[model samples]
Target: MNTLAHGFADGPGPGPWILFVPLMWALVVGGGLFLLRRAGWRGRAPWQQGRAALGEQSPIVVLGRRFAAGEID
Candidate 1:
């Protein structure tokens, strides 16, 4: 019987490819998290920032703009 017919009979066990799967998964998850964070998924989004900036305006300023735009009397 040829020992080579059976894998790892006398040769080295597994190669570095054994760790590639988990490493790829870790990279995929980590990259996704990084993208989410960069896209402001964890904090205020761009639209929210615009709203916050508008909100920061003084009430009188908002009223003046509304009156100028004829939104209110």
Candidate 2:
């Protein structure tokens, strides 16, 4: 019989080893996210980065807002 009651009538199959799939996936995803954060991904928004890169005098930003407001073509 299956140790964790997860097999069929043909005796035990993978038993509890099937749980390793999810555990391994969790570790992989969590590790990837942690490494990404350590590599300088502090979750800053796109607009924040754009403003910091171009400063307050950027014409593209003003033009983008004007386009959104339909002020000019």
Candidate 3:
């Protein structure tokens, strides 16, 4: 008999292996983000990098440069 069919027929499958999905997702995603940032991928690439490179600059930095340039009061 197929063990998977029997298990699901019983209910909820079985052991804690269900938790592996989220764990694996976190490992893949978090590890990728960490590696990207560590390698200075932030604000460097257009597609391969993350949000820090997407031209989403903070207001403070923009304002600072504007003030220095006498563009704003």
lDDT of each: 0.72, 0.79, 0.70
Candidate 2: misplaced stretches above 4 Å? 1-10, 50-73
**Residue 49 deviation, candidate 2, in Å?**
3.6
Clashing pairs in 3: none
lDDT of 2 by residue, 1-73 (tens): 2365565556657766688889999999999999988987779975666676776578887888899999998
Each prediction's total of clashing residue pairs, residues at least 3 apart in sequence or on different chains, is 0, 0, 0
Name the lDDT value of residue 56 in candidate 3.
Answer: 38
Question: Which digits, one per residue and each the tens of the lDDT, describe model 3 over residues 1-73?
Answer: 5454234555655445667778999999999999988977756556545445645375666888899999999
User: What is the clash count of model 1?
Assistant: 0
Q: Highest lDDT: which candidate? A: 2
After aligning candidate 1 to the native by TM-score, how far in Å is the CA of 3 from where it should be?
A: 15
Q: Compute each candidate's TM-score over C-alphas.
A: 0.45, 0.46, 0.41
- Ordered list by lDDT, greatest first: 2, 1, 3
Write the number of the candidate with greater lDDT, choosing between 1 and 2. Answer: 2
Which of the numbered candidates is closest to the native, going by highest TM-score? 2
Q: List the residue pairs that clash in candidate 2.
A: none
